[model samples]
Target chain A: DVKVTQSSRYLVKRTGEKVFLECVQDMDHENMFWYRQDPGLGLRLIYFSYDVKMKEKGDIPEGYSVSREKKERFSLILESASTNQTSMYLCATDPGDSRYEQYFGPGTRLTVT
Target chain B: AQSVTQPDIHITVSEGASLELRCNYSYGATPYLFWYVQSPGQGLQLLLKYFSGDTLVQGIKGFEAEFKRSQSSFNLRKPSVHWSDAAEYFCAVRGYQKVTFGTGTKLQVIP
Candidate 1:
């Protein structure tokens, strides 16, 4: 069984604050992803890391960045959190060999006030 | 670009009734398809996935999905519904390095 753990389940931050969401996977998957889920928008990718120190921007990467200093950990950073950035953030990991089924974390519901 | 569409936004079914959720995709070739379930305030769980082999695939929780090449649809089905089956279902299509998810369908199981 693969386990993906997120640092926080819920968080609250003021506007213009810097926020960090951490994710760790025990499976040592090669690909890690960060996504924000909205009611009508589904899961939109914010950023993804294929390897250590390698990152790519997903569809919506505007105020967000990612860090993958190690193979087992991936972190998502919000440079300047805004009210619009409040969302349910999910972290997922996928082994490159698997058929693209990603294991997800419990998600962090961030509230930017 | 790859995309997935879930037509139904909300569905209501009684316990022991049949269940079906519609999903469609747009891509050049046969892409990886997946169905996920998310409980309230929880993360998404993989129910089933269709990679390459057979058109019909079985997943966890007595759920199954069939891939139709002609229709470009991968619809999920269950023989009988349970109260615990109430959740949000998302259909996803995965390309080489990208995965596109649907808006999801909320299922309500009536007593």
Candidate 2:
């Protein structure tokens, strides 16, 4: 079975503090994505990585950035966390096959005070 | 531009009652449709997908969705709803490398 794991399940940080959310997938997939979930707004993509050291901004990438240093791990970084950035963060990976199905991680809920 | 819509924001159904969740999409060409379920504090789980033929696609947890090209809709249905089925359901559409998700419908199962 394919599994995606996030470093933290819940996190609380002060506003302006730097935050790091880590995601690792064991499926050896080529594509990884970061999304933030908010009530009523649903899931909005923050960033995505198609290969190691390659990243692209998604729909709502304003206050977020990403790094893909290795094939199995992708990291989401918040240069300066803010209250508005509080959200449930999700990580997903696509198997690169034409199907384009994404497997997701358990999610990290971040609360910026 | 491709987009996905889940008109109903929230749905409430009694346990064991039949349920249907609507999803509509707008894409230029053939789309890859998917239905995912997210429990509280958990990630989204793939419930079903529709890529091509066989309009009616069966999924895990006794859930099924049908793709209708004429209607541009892929609606999910279940014969019976369980309390555990109460969660946020998302419908997504893939075009090339990008996937667009619906706003999501939060299901509430009444005992």
Candidate 3:
């Protein structure tokens, strides 16, 4: 079975602190994505990478950035954490083929105090 | 631009009852449609998707959705609801290089 692992299941950070959320997929997929899930807004894409070292901004890219150093690993970076930025973050990957289904990680819950 | 709408914000049903969740889309042409479920503090899981060919698509966990072009709706249905099926459901439409998800509908399972 394909597994997408998130480094941290729960995290708490102070305001103005830098934070990193790591995601690794064992499926050898080519596409990776980062999204922030909120109560009423649902899952809003923050960024996505189709290949290593190539990233694209998504609908809610503001105040967030991502890095894909290796094909299996993707990282989401919060330059300065704030209370408003606290939310459940999700990682996903899509195989490079006609199967457009995206597999998701367990998710990281971040709380900024 | 392609967009998705889940009109129902919340719905409650007793266990073993029938279920239906509505989804609407706005697109110039036929677009890729999808339904996903998210449990509390978990990532969204793909329930089903409609690309082409058949209008009615069966998905995991005994869930199915039918695409209606005339009404611009893709409604999810299940013959019997389970308590474990209570979760937030989202509808999405894939556009150029990205996909937009609806706000989501929260399901409550009553005894």
Candidate 4:
């Protein structure tokens, strides 16, 4: 079975706090993605990495960054957490084929105060 | 450029009634289409996907979606709805390299 796990299922951070969200996949996939879900905005891509040490910005990458030091692990970092950044963050991994579907983690609900 | 759209922000259906969620996309050619369901606090689950071959595709939870190239749409449908089916559904399209997601449609199944 394919499994994707996140470091935290729920998180709370104060303003100006540095937040780190970790994601790990056992599928050995080369592509990983990070997205945030809001009330009506749906899932907006934050960042994605094709392979280790490679990253690409998505439509909404402001105030967010990503790290892919290892093939199975991808991390999303927030330099400074804000109230507006409070949302459900999801991590996903692709099977390296554009025609294939992506596997997702349980997601982290972050509350920034 | 490639984009996906889900016209309905919210939909309500009875537990035993039929359900349909609409999705549309715009691209040079038919892109890889997918439908995902997100529970209240869970990750997005892939309902179904359509790349080529058959236009109608069946998915988990007895859900299905049809691909209409002429209409540029891939609408998800289910013959009967269940209370457990109340969740947010997202439509996604993958182009050459990256995947683009629609705003999403929220489904509310009533008992």
Candidate 5:
């Protein structure tokens, strides 16, 4: 079974605080992705990594950055959290071997107060 | 940029009734389409995908989708919907380097 785990299910942070969301995939997939799900906007990709230490920005990467030092672990960083950044964050993994299917984690709901 | 659209925001169907959810997309070339279901507070689960070949694709939980190239639509259908089938359904299309998803359609199955 392909399992993707996230660091937190729910998080609360004050404005201007730095927050980090961690994700780990057990399937050893080469491609990892971070997306934010909003009410009407659907899932907007924040960033994705094709390989270790290589990351690419997605549709909405303005307030976030990503790190993938190791193959199994990918981290999403909020340089300075803001109220507008509060949303449900999801992490996903693709086999990168032409499978074209992505497995997703439960998701992390972040609240900026 | 390429995009996807789910015409209906929500659809309610009785248990054992047939259901169909509409999805349309605008892609330059041959499109890779996918249908995913997400339960509340959970991640998205792949229902089915259409890359090429057959137009009708069968998926898990007795769900199926038909791809129509002329209409630019891939609509999901189920002969009999169960109460547990209530969830959010998202249609996606692979465009450029990433996959673009629709706003999603919330399915409500009534007993």
Candidate 6:
């Protein structure tokens, strides 16, 4: 079965702490995306990669960086976790669909204090 | 820029009751739309999508969505909702390069 897995379901970190959220997709999709979901803002794209070691910033990429060293994995990095950075992070991969239908991970809810 | 909108913030329905969640979008060209369900803390699961062809699209978990280009809407529907259907539903539209999602509508199914 096609699958997208995240490193954590829930995490808590203090302000100024660096954080890493990992996403791995079993399907060898060409494009990967990172999104931040807020209470009323839906999901905002943070970063996306069409290939390994290549990345593009999305609507909200500030305070967040992404790395894609492997075709199967993508990582989101927070330079310093702040209270405003607390949100649910979602990772998705496109199965090369022309319309860009995405497969998503379970998501990681990060809490910064 | 293209965008999607879900007007309802929340809706509650009884088990076995019919359900409909409204979604609308704004795009210059033929829009690619999607409906996704998020269960509690889990990620969003694709319920259905509409690119072209039939305006009415069937999806997983007995869900369906209809695309109305005239109205710029893609509304999700179910004949009968189950208790397990309680979740947040999001409508999305694929713009030129990226997909923009609506804030979402939270569904609550009660017995």
Poorly placed runs, candidate 1 (over 4 Å)? none
By lDDT, highest first, what's the ranking? 1, 2, 5, 4, 6, 3
For residue A1, what is the lDDT in candidate 1? 90
C-alpha lDDT (0 to 100) for residue A107 of candidate 5? 98
Model 2 is docked with a DockQ of 0.77
Q: Itemize residue pairs with steric clashes in candidate 4.
A: none
User: Model 5, range A1-113, lDDT digits (tens) per residue?
Assistant: 99999999999999999999999999889899999999878899999998999999999999899999999999999999999999999999988743377899999999999
- The list of candidate 4 runs beyond 4 A from truth reads none
Which structure among the candidates has the greatest DockQ?
4
DockQ of prediction 3: 0.64
Best by TM-score: 1
- Candidate 3 chain A: worst 10 consecutive residues by lDDT? A94-103
Ranked by TM-score, the better of candidates 5 and 6 is 5
Task: List, residue by residue over B5-110, the lDDT tens digit for candidate 1.
Answer: 9999999999999999999999897789999999998999999999899999999999999999999999999999999999999999998887889999999999
Candidate 2, B39-58: lDDT as tens digits? 98789999999998999999
Error of 2 at B87 (Å): 1.2
Q: Can you write out model 2's per-residue Cα lDDT over A1-113, one digit (the tens) per residue?
A: 99999999999999999899999999899999999988998889899988999999999999888989999999999999999998899999998764767999999989999
The collision pairs in model 3 are none
In candidate 5, how many Å is residue A88 off?
0.3
Which residue pairs does candidate 6 place in steric collision?
A: none
lDDT of 4 by residue, B33-62 (tens): 999998887898899999999999999999
Per-prediction TM-score, chain B alone: 0.98, 0.99, 0.97, 0.97, 0.98, 0.98
Instruction: Tell me the tens digit of each residue's lDDT in model 3 across A28-82.
Output: 9998999898888978999999999999998889888888989999999999998
Question: Per-prediction DockQ scores?
Answer: 0.77, 0.77, 0.64, 0.84, 0.62, 0.74
Docking class of 3: medium
Error of 6 at A75 (Å): 0.9
Candidate 6: stretches off by over 4 Å:
none
**Measured by TM-score, how close is model 1 to the native structure?**
0.98
